[model samples]
Target: MASFGIIGSKGRMGQALASAVEEAGHTLAGGVDAGELPGPLALQADVLIDFSAPAALEANLKVARVAGVPILIGTTGLDDTNFAAIKDAAKAIPVLQTGNTSLGVTLLSALVKQAAERLGDDWDIEVLEMHHRHKVDAPSGTAKLLGEAAARGRGVYLEEKMESGRHGQTGARKSGDIGFATLRGGSVAGDHSVIFAGEQERLTLSHSAENRTIFARGAVRGAEWLIGKPQGRYTMEDVLDL
Candidate 1:
């Protein structure tokens, strides 16, 4: 069994991941929070799993790189700067990152891609997501991931086609534009829906996460899979073989 090290040890997702690691019969190398240094845990673990804040990404990557260990990044709300750091670190060690690490979400992305490819632009695509009230980011990272899948199916870039938060007097919805809506409230674990709206018919694909354990289990599975993998960037799709 692999030894797992956790970042953000005190947070909700971090605690869930710790439990998952134990349930999977793996060793808990140790954990580090925002104010803690990751060097000690990084040195002891076979692989590192990060569910910390975006602000802590660079420091965590440094520890993983120095320790020569593979890492699975589950932190959301990351910006381009964080992604650049991850890409750099992947050159020296295996790195798997995802917005949502649930097996259901991984499969759902594949289904969304197929649906987007089969449906013509006449079918307007819209993505909607809702998370816990404490979530800091808008549109949620999973929404962006689903949008990327849709864009890939359509042979377009998400940046060009994504339309988020329409306001008053916003002109009619543009053809082929992928829209996004977000809601934040209560203790929602996570919820996502992709709608293909076409004349006289509509198709909606959705997944609702009842709790964080699904993601925690997926993260542990990913960390285990990353062991012995070649240095490169990967995703939940690779971990789940989707």
Candidate 2:
């Protein structure tokens, strides 16, 4: 069984991950959260799973690298600079990072890509996502991911054509632009939809997480899949073979 260490031990997702790891017949080496990074994390487990905040990610990743342990990072809210650090760390250890961990979400991304490609840029792509009230990022990482998939399908850079929702009489939607809409409410686990709006037809691809355990399970699965892999960055799409 895989020996696992969780980086965000006290948070909701962290607790869920710990439980899932144990339930999956894996050993929980230890956990680190906030100011509590546990002692010698690298010696305690074969792999590390990070569901912590952006501030804690780099430190935990460094710990993983020094120990030669692979890491599966699930935290969101990291900007390009922080992401660059992750890429740097991947030089020595296998790292798997994902915006969302639900296997269904990765499959939805694939389907969205196919739809965007088949339907062509003539179809406007719009991403709608909703998460729990505590989620910190607007447009959620999942929203940006869906937009990226659409952008990739259209063979364009995401920044050049993606429109993250507009307000105040935004006029008509721009052509070939991928739009994003976000909503936060109650304790929603997650919900994402990709709408391809074209003349006389509309195609919507969506995934809803009824329980956060889906993410926890995926993270554990990813950690198990990452053991002993060569140094590189990977995604859940790789995990699920999408």
**lDDT (CA) per prediction:** 0.94, 0.88
List the RMSD of every prediction in angstroms: 0.8, 1.1
Q: Could you give me the TM-score of model 2 versus the true structure?
A: 0.97
Candidate 2's residue-wise lDDT over 70-182, tens digit each? 99988888898779989999998999998888888888889888888888678888899999998888888888888888888898989999787698999988888888888
lDDT by residue (tens digit), candidate 1, 141-234: 8999999999999999999999996999999999999999999999999999999999999999999999999999988888889999999999
Question: Ten-residue segment with the worst summed lDDT in candidate 1?
Answer: 233-242
Q: What's the CA error at residue 151 for candidate 1, in Å?
A: 0.7
Candidate 1 regions off by >4 Å? Answer: none
Q: Provide the global lDDT of candidate 1 against the true structure.
A: 0.94
lDDT of 1 at 214: 96
Cα lDDT for residue 178, candidate 2: 84
